[model samples]
Target: MPATGRENHTAPKAVYIHIPFCTNKCFYCDFNSYVLKDQPVMDYLRALDREMELTVRETPPGEIKTIFVGGGTPTVLNPQEMEFFLNSVKKNFPNWAEDIEFTMEANPGTTDRDKLAVMKAGGVNRVSFGVQAFQNELLSGIGRIHNTDDVYRSLENARNAGLDNLSIDLMFGLPNQTVEMLDYSVSKALELGLTHYSIYSLKVEENTLFHTLFQKNQLPLPSEEDELKMYQLLMDRMQAAGYKQYEISNFAKPGFESRHNMTYWRNEDYYGLGAGAHGYVNRRRHMNIKGVNPYVEAAMQKLPRLEQFSVPEAEAMEDFVMVGLRMLDGIRSADFAAQFGVSLEETFGRELHKMLSSGLLEEHEDRGGYRLTGKGVVFGNEVFAEFIGVLT
Candidate 1:
């Protein structure tokens, strides 16, 4: 079998770089990103390079297995800037594994042929297009500047640039979204025959336009029953079409599961670079400074860390359960013991007994692990909550 992952990590094998520039902010997005019209793009890139230099000097990475460049639309960079940035990444993370899954998040409208070419030459083998909806009006209402036309154009450009590992994002439970509308959108997505698909429910986050509208009863959202129906329909359709539900919201073909995302769910260590990025290493978690100039200036002198804290043992235990349960295969008791040095039953026997008796969890058939039952998936929050604060 190919090397899946190591049980213990001495250094980060996965890396995440954040690009915080976007042409426009989506109404439902609350991520740490900025609109790019008047931002200091070049200076930020230089500072990013400096930060990576300092970080690698302190704690160099192993052969990088995964590198995910997420953004406020990483494809917003021009060809020249993209080339410079990718070169800096190569310089810092010098050693890469044989099967490095280098992914760059792109907005559908931002990636032209030239930009796609730069990304391919820079070692980016996978591209995830943020095509939230296929409907033009819904796209406009959600504050995305791209339409269905740009989605096709961007994918064509990516393919032309020699990239076939492509994925697209879709959102359900959106404003004015009916079950029928979601059905139509899913049908359009499945027709494309992409390797991976991520369908997420919209959450009204604070400081977003959607939140303001929702407060004033201006945002028209699907009813609770309708949203549930959309979720069920999507699960059924994806499974029928032979896409595996590898995670709660992700579906992919065999061997095409997102290695970078699995790193997070498996609680692996990774390096985080750029403004407002978060990372966990050496049993501590850190978030970088959020403001653009502040991060740039700080990176010049030192690492641009705004907050860092050592995770206590009990809290780490809770995090293991919360993060691991997101995977449908669930957490293995032996793997848990290998990481935390305690048996799963000994640590959470009370909680496990309760969850098992209530039919929220059951022993996974092929492995000695516990996974969510069908009812548990719907009420997953309740199950996760039971594990939290139980040990800590």
Candidate 2:
């Protein structure tokens, strides 16, 4: 796949590439990732390169505005492997926006100075580190390999490599965590003065170590009230530090909002490549094969799809509302009308009236849309749940 002059401006503008190799799996993670030892790393990268070649031939990309490389810790790749993978991206998706937001996810201890330099030279301008907790005990409790010192060292490496758009993820509601502990974590995180922060509450997903411990009542998670307090404290602290809550769990300095994630909230199209990645484009969604060997074998001959389906119109409309409500700015009524050829009220009048009456939603003061109220923000799952079966 060489650079081409023809540009399909309406094609998918966002790309999500998954690297499924991790040094160790976290206790709470159920994502399709595996331990890196003895894994066929080069074979998988070559297969991903083939997938990209086939993907753009099927749906030629526009001037790509955002490209996100997610993982099992993408920074785990050595400098040589990193260079090859990034070169494959540039070859397939040749037309890039001048100010494209190319981001890679990293684990704190995994990113060294030399690897960070390779990432920057490969056109990665942003990095998001998975610094789940500030406390060493909590970090170990969650099976994270990195400590507080590693977080600072990784951030320094990123900056030294000339990649300054940085973000760190902090978790609340961890096993044996307290509100004060969360407050301390947020305070330490804010002290870094990074460009963005993502604060997430822990969810004990099935098949994870946490879930197994939880089933036996072994995980000492914070109580609901303490978790709620943690959420409130983090929000207040982030606001005081001048970071805007652009989405439910994401906060950023002005103009530092994650454009790649915004593509999902806006219900736009994107290419999902690599093992176990799910992509949405042209109203169709597909998930690639989950196993490394299977994905590599399949991609050499075809798209390596494990499953594919076209989203029904009714479900697409419901998705538009569900994901759009995640952003603080909310969904514009005109955008919905333009996409569906019907007013938002005409399609979801009953549901809208119910939520509006309950005070979970409010009309946008300066825009033609509706946004979540404070109460709605806290109980977002309940609000999003209302849209699911209503469309079906």
Candidate 3:
């Protein structure tokens, strides 16, 4: 028996590749991406190839079910760079599932006909564009190089290249953004008639420009009331338009749900390749080196891993409950027992009872285990916080 890219061969069923290069840094972004200026571009690509080769040889993937290329912007890669990167991916983990969902995160202006064509030919079946807002001012405020026109142009280019399993990202709670602005963005997104929509609220994370602005009372973010209204309106509009809120932030048509993302929400193992990428396999988790030069130098011998640790069972169970609870369908009792060889009730009964009593968690009549109720969704952080290290 060999690894079929599943549990059979002790290999992860999913893979995540990181390309940490961007055209320019977004004010709201704090990801591990560097500016694409005077950097060793080809050296990084070759280093990624080296990392992939070393990784798959050691772990020897089974049959990869999903592969996601995420980054500062994977589309920032030129046609040649895109081809080279995808080639390394295929060479290292060749055995793929029949319906492997390959996705790449792209920016609007960076993606052109040639690069998209290269991507489609390189086994990327899905393209998720980062089109946060349709208004030009909003786009400029965020330091995003792409405009509304570029969004239209990029989508047209992606479609013309024969890639229609597409999705676009939207944001709410932006600086100087209004409820009407979110409504306009949603209208434009629905007008595109795409497959999926990932509408996320803006969180002012530390070390980001937005965070600094907030500390100085200069970031003109939407009022908390307005932000919440924006979220509620988005849910209503997407539901009216026939998209399912599959995850907290994601909405998709019936069959067009992001399989690659679901792989993470389901708490499955995945191979993480490239600099600053993270992977969880065989109950151990590790992140690659963040610096480009260090990762490249280290991959010549072994993976440029920054941290690695085996997950304890208690911690693993806590993770399962936290991540699994984010979906619309929620976690199941049967699935819990299958994974942990113990009943869900046996571990989180006290916690479940507490949430249920507070109307934050509800037992699904049809599917069994608990799910977040409508109120629970609003107070998700409160609910999730209770699960961490609960078993301990």
Give me the candidate number with maximum lDDT.
Answer: 2
lDDT of 2 by residue, 360-388 (tens): 99999688889999999998888899899
Ranking by TM-score: 2, 1, 3
Instruction: Candidate 1: give the clashing pairs.
Output: none
Candidate 2: worst 10 consecutive residues by lDDT? 1-10
Query: Candidate 3: where are CA atoms >4 Å away?
Result: 1-9
Over 286-359, each residue of candidate 1 has an lDDT whose tens digit, in order, gives 99999999999999999999999988878887888888888888888877787777788898999988999999
Cα displacement (angstroms), candidate 2, residue 64, comes to 0.3
lDDT of each: 0.91, 0.93, 0.89
lDDT-based ranking: 2, 1, 3
Clashes of each: 0, 0, 5
Task: List candidate 1 stretches off by more than 4 Å.
Answer: 1-9
How far residue 140's Cα lies from its native spot in candidate 2, in Å, is 0.4
**TM-scores, in order shown?**
0.97, 0.97, 0.96
